[model samples]
Target: MPALTDKQKRFVAEYLVDLNATQAAIRAGYSAKTAEQQASRLLRNVQVRAAVEQGQQKTAAKLEVTKERIVEELAKIGFSNMLDYMRAGHDGDPYLDFSELTRDQAAALSEVTVEDFKDGRGEDARDVRRVKFKLHDKKGALVDLAKMLGFMVEKHEVTGKDGGPIQTETRTWREVLRQEKKG
Candidate 1:
């Protein structure tokens, strides 16, 4: 086996830090065809291996910081859980009426309801609101309401025919109830 020069070893270490062997080879002034061979030799060097390990540690720390930033940003927007954060991705709209949510939408929202929420262990002041309600099917069989509706409870302002505020709170889907009764 041929030993790598000091310069080659350093190149390998730097390339392995962020780029795969092929990319590192090209960056290190080697042809693309030679990149794999150069990377292989570099991996065999004990000194280069140590450098790669140290670089990996630093990279992992940086990724952790990025993850924390995302979590903080989500929290600022009243997303108490990752589920809420991800659900907001659907339709690229942050605000959604509860009735507009489908079964899949509800399931995604429900994932954020931790045991703490059920036990009332913390103050609930997040933008997302939770409501408890029962759902019945056409035969009057009690459906799994929470499972069907998810975690978010929506309240809408009632409006008159002329779009005047009626000062009443109403659910978003009166039609769904009618459909359920007929089914």
Candidate 2:
């Protein structure tokens, strides 16, 4: 394969930043009007595609990212349970107790809030502590993990009304010309 041009090399580098082809083409100095087409054509070129793959591999290696690590991270969020972070006290009231929380379990927590306030007035005043926490999107994490593991495949069915075969119209230019002449 022929070597990639300077603009193509730049496009590969920019593409690695976010994997957006049109933006990469634009950043590589391609005209905005044609950036989408330029990106499409450049990505189809064998040499440019190889360069992009090489760039991606280099990035993954540099970041120390691996398939197992990604799956493990997703699982930590997917399989997390609120019970893992809470426990019942002697009063039988459940409270946020992170005393024995593991790093993996903590990874699921997205937010934590603690409020200290007086619950009553005058002689009946009592200090109250409130704790709230939100977890990461478990469903999203599970879905992503399932897709990565090939356990989930999104299927799309295109059909006409009532699930029948798609309806299409095919017309010849000659027929259109004759109709136009009659009109």
TM-score each candidate.
0.31, 0.78
Candidate 2, run of 10 with poorest lDDT:
174-183
Candidate 1 regions exceeding 4 Å error are: 1-6, 13-17, 62-183
- For residues 35-62, could you state the per-residue lDDT of candidate 2 as single tens digits? 9988998999999999998988898899
RMSD of 2: 6.3
Model 1 lDDT-worst window of ten: 134-143
Pick the lDDT winner: 2
Query: In angstroms, how far off is 147's CA in candidate 2?
Result: 1.6
For 134-154, candidate 1 gives per-residue lDDT tens digits of: 221312111223223444455
Clashing residue pairs in candidate 2 (N, C-alpha, C atoms within 3 angstroms) = none
